[model samples]
Target chain A: MNNWKIFSNGLFKENPVFVLLLGMCPTLGVTTSAINGLGMGLATTFVLLLSNVTISLVSNLIPDKIRIPGYIVIIATVVTILEICMAAYLPALHEALGIFIPLIVVNCIVLGRAEAFAAKNTPLSSLLDGLGMGLGFTLGLALLGSTREILGSGKLFNATLYDENYGILVFVLAPGAFIALGYLIAIINKIKKSL
Target chain B: MEKRLESNFKNMVLVLCAITLFSSLSVASINALTAEKLNEVRLQNQLKAIRDVLPAFDNNPMEESDTLITPDGGTLVLFPASREGERVGTAVKSYSNNGYSGPIWLMIGFTPDGAVYNYTVLEHKETPGLGSKMSTWFARGNKGDITGQIPGSKGLRARKDGGEIDAITAATVSSRAFLDAVNRASGALSGNADAVSGATGLEASPGATPVEQPDATTGATPVEEPDASSGATRVDDPSRTDTSLPDTTHLSPARHE
Candidate 1:
């Protein structure tokens, strides 16, 4: 496989969020604003990259039947490290992410990449896959966050675009998440079909 | 194809244990490295909260903070702000557990003469558009503004309860909880020792009134003695107090720091 293709596959062709439909919990929960979505995506990306690299390094040592448990232990440890470090250094972002930070331990995207790609690939390829997938996921979240924030709060990246009072409140709530995500997926599907 | 290592019990246990051990070591080291910085960040946030509610003071309010036992068994941390050796006022960290989302914490400021200076919501989980309005809803211009009002002369309950304060649009429960916290702080500052009597119905008054409400506002007096006096309640233990508390306070302008 071409190195570039392996790296860029996650951006569009094999996008984890829109295409693969991985990591839906954070996708709907924290993408209420552009900043939050981007923040969460980046945090997840960091975890994905680290876990992918580490899992690839140790894949040969683990038996197939116990692979899932091994992957989970590694991912949980990385997540705990990330959580503590963020709480200590990036207190603002840590608080902003709140419960979602710890929830990343169970984020299927991290574990999925570890099993599907990292377990079978070399360290360098696994790293690129993680990066590509992370970027794709981040972009999807940003798109959703911007859509929700714009319609629901009349703001972009915390900047006000219009009278916030006139915003459609539903876009920022639970139902709004489903509505926006459904429309976003529909649009992406149309784009892919035309391409 | 050569059969890879079997998923035998021994192999699985060994692999899992190895991963757990490595992860544990890595996490422990990272935690050790970041723990101090996290504490510093938390303290800075607290300092910022205290500064937001209280007026300017020449002395360092952080060092001057003292713990006071409220009439209702809650321990309040009072930060005294002073200028030129004269006591300006005090900010009290108070909590009301009656919030719709459980406990709501507030940092309330009181002038020397018993008027509200300002207040800031420290922590809360109230509904966003409704109860979360407590953040700035009680400012000087908001409909439920509590700034400059004397909770002593005018009662602290919402108008729904026959008091003068206004409630949030759709968050009466949160509004009541907020007022209860503010009133508790005000009661602590009234220096009547039996100040909790005024804050009844909102709090759980267990049994006998035990602790003397030490007037920390009389001068730069520390709350150590009153904290010791309230040792019987177990609620006022200095070690067990919610380390970061909020409320209004009695202003004593003495330079203890």
Candidate 2:
């Protein structure tokens, strides 16, 4: 595949959240607000990018039987580094993300890319793939979070658009996450079909 | 495609060991780099909470803080703030074990007469969107506003428990726990240590006498110790009375660096 094609594949055609439907745990858990969604997306993106490059570089050295465990260790280490950096610099966002940051180690997208794309591809292509996929995930989460925030709280990114009392409360709850995700998938699917 | 190594037992073990070793090394180095900054961040957050809960004061409440033993064997730390020479308010780091999910920590400030000035949730594992609302649920203008209210003076219980304050929607357990912490903080601040036990409703004595209510308005004196002289019930060790102030030098230059 061409360089741009490899990079842009994750953005639309193979988007992690909307199209491929990977990493649903954080997708549904932290998208309570637009900023939270964005933060989680970026954190995942950082892990995906770093792990992809590291795995691609070291894929040749790893034996096939232990690759899964190998990939997980790399991903977890990257996540721990991210967690420490976030706690030190962005304390508020760190607190807000809370348990979700550590949970990123288990996010299938990081491992999925390492197994499917990064392990087979060159380090540069893996880097681009990770970036594209990470951005795609970020985009999906931010959109979902914004939709829920607006519908549930009459606010977008915490900027009040109208009185919150008039807003639908269910959209900000767990059921709302499912409902919003379902409709969003439908909408994205429709757009993809039309294109 | 690049040729891969065979999945032999020795290869698998060696590769996995190398990977784990590198991962741990990286994690350890990163942790080392960020450990100091993390500690500073936590200290800054605590200082900010103390400021938010208490009224304006010039003296370092942290420096003049006191630790008291609660009736239930927990230690409550009091940061008594003073404006110029007169006492302003005392911020208590109080906790409750009755939250819906787990324990809830709160920094509650009280005026000299024991009315709540303001409060901030220090830590909690409460359910998000419901119990987590406790952070803002009892702030000044919110529906469950407990500001300016005395804990033992009247009903501090949730409306479900026949109190005046409105509980957060679908979060009665969290609200009750919050009130319990506030009441305990108040009890400790007023030197009415028996009131703390009564608030928990575990042992409600019909006529629980107030333990020596120390006048908090006095200049820079530690508030009445919660029967610290009575070695039997005191939880905090005498050697470290100001244990709440953890290594101030580490956090002093938090802003500068």
Candidate 3:
């Protein structure tokens, strides 16, 4: 019960994107298209999960002096795996997301997990913590992406609901990402406040 | 006591070695596992882009003679294109440094005689509603018929800005930069086809990675994208990247870089 409560905190109480504000690079960049946001999010999530598990397993084995380097090597290795997989299977999405895929290595969320949660927690708990944080981060990105896409594109996942020809263009650009992120943060805050 | 300290140090060294060895080994293993799939996917992407241009052509980048150059100035790649001997078209990844937002990487396509056939925006940091829309309807409509021979000179610019091409609404900067890159790439091939027939040439260079896509195929015809009437968001372009992330300072036109 106690473990579940701790794991649940990351999902809502301390969500990485809304609550903690980690992994802003990808959150801001890839959320232009909802699908791109989802793909990039999953890629980050996959990396966060795998790196957390691996880091937890070898936490004691790594010397304190060299742990930071060790974590980076592990995270980079995971990111490369995610990148290659995306390139191979989802080429279009891969193209859409572009360098943000490589930029996953430097995302603070993954590194924060390794240091704060994985370094001290049991392997199972570490995995859960990483997964929760990843899901939370992904949720934020998807929400922002969908909001922006609907406004900017008049559609969701490329399916035209209203009329894209009449859609607002600001919702699709870099500026859109910022505007959407702000509104999203505000909404999440509202909900938090209400609760 | 001294002997014990020596044993502890040796143990620490061994663990460090183990971590290094295993990490490299895992990364190498994952890389090897995904390399082939990555190549196959990239080939398919090249094909998909070509289909968007030459819809009638069924073959892809894999079937054509691989002549695309790598970004790092290493080996030249040749796609098995063309029928029996004659080349139909070739796509070259290129870049431009004059986007409305910033630099953009693009892929330019041309025929065997070195005439531009099509192009796509590979990657960029352009303004989304304004400059970034160059990749959508505008480029698609414009990509099919935007080519013309300048006889002795390479001409590439938006028609609005005194060039042969039309610019997208509020996206003139991207249009100019994109067309310029394509013109330069096609012009380069035109210049060197006689000197280097079989050799692959880079549009940008091997050094410029993360190349932006610029899909401007029509030299004469123009593509129309969606409208931006409802978008009043005033997020300002930071005009800086890498070394120059703009400071927010909590002002209007929230920094969107």
Candidate 4:
């Protein structure tokens, strides 16, 4: 496939959250606010891109029997670097993301892409794929976060749009995550059908 | 067929080991590079917490901090607030193991006379909306405000326990923990400066040998004296009477007024 097809594929056709439904844990957990969603999305994207490129580069050297563990170590290392960098320079965001930041090591999308695509593809293609998938994940999280934040708390990105007390409190809680993600998937499905 | 299987297993083990070594080395180096910066951020956060609870002081509180061991075996770091050569107040980094979820950490500031200047929850995992209200719920004008109250003059328990302070709505456990942390901090500061300093050095370390006690003339040894009114026995371990006092005499006598 051409570069455009490789990159755009994850953006829509194989979207990690809405289409493939990977990384549901963070999608549902940190999308309490638009900023938190975006922060989580960006951090995951950083990990995905680096892991994809590195896995593709080293795929040849890794034996088939040990490929899963090899990929995991690489992804975990990348996540650790990201975690330390955030804690040192972006302390506020680091605090806001809390435990979810470290949990990125277990994110399925990073490993899934490494096993399914990056291992088989060239480094360039893998890089494109990571960028595309990461962007798609970010978009999905941002959407879910905005919906929940606006409905559950009457605020967007922590900026109060109205009296926050007037919000539908449940949307900001755990159940609200499932409800929001469910409706968002339905909307995406409808749009894809029309397209 | 046996040779092929042996070679395959060997390759797998070699690849895993090589990858692990590389990963470990990289993580170690990055940790080294960022460790200092991480500590700086942590110190800044702590200083900010101390400043939030205590009045303004000229000296850097982080530099003036000393670790004291609570009776329950937890470490309490006391940040002494001072201006010029005089001490203003003290903000104690205290924790209580009695929270609903787990330990609740608080930075509680006390004037030299023992009245609470103010307090702020440094960290907590209490239930949101209910237990987490212990953050601001214990401040002045709030339902559980204990600001300006002396911890030793009366028990700082929730009213349910027959104390003057109100508990957080539906969060009596968290309220109790918060008050307990404040009480621990205040108890540390109630004695003369030298005695508390000596106690900090002696008690802060778990396995270290207890040092000699300071001169009795300082009158700070009264901290370990059993109080008949409080109905608590304070058995002083003879060995931990001193490790040299951490100059708490910098505190201005004016604060006692």
Model 3 Cα lDDT, one tens digit per residue, B168-247: 66665566666655654554354433211223322222222112112221212111111112111111111111101111
- Please give the fraction of native interface contacts (Cα pairs under 8 Å between A and B) kept by each candidate: 0.71, 0.91, 0.48, 0.51
Better of 2 and 4 by lDDT: 2
Best-to-worst ranking by TM-score:
2, 1, 4, 3
Across B156-231, the per-residue lDDT of candidate 1 in tens digits comes to 7678667677888767778877887787677566652334322331232223213222332232335534534443
Write down the lDDT that model 4 would get: 0.77
The candidate maximizing DockQ is: 2
DockQ of every candidate:
0.52, 0.79, 0.29, 0.29
Q: Each model's C-alpha lDDT?
A: 0.77, 0.81, 0.63, 0.77
TM-score of chain B of 4: 0.72
Candidate that scores best on lDDT: 2
List the RMSD of every prediction in angstroms: 9.1, 10.0, 12.3, 9.8
Which whole-number lDDT from 0 to 100 does residue B36 have in model 1? 89
Better of 2 and 4 by TM-score: 2
RMSD of 1: 9.1
lDDT, candidate 1, A1-195, per-residue tens: 978999899999988878898899999999888998999999999999999999898898889998998899899998999999888888888877888988998989999899899988988999999999999999999999999999988999989999977888789877898999999999999988998
lDDT of 4 by residue, B1-257 (tens): 01111328778888889999999999999999999999999988898888898888889878777886543367788889998868889998988776776788999998877889998887887754457668788898987889888876343766866678888765666777777777767656664232234534344333221222234314454443322123221112221232111112211222210
Across all candidates, the chain A TM-score values are 0.98, 0.99, 0.94, 0.98
Candidate 4, residue B32: how far the Cα is off, in Å: 1.4
Ranking 2 against 4 by DockQ, winner: 2
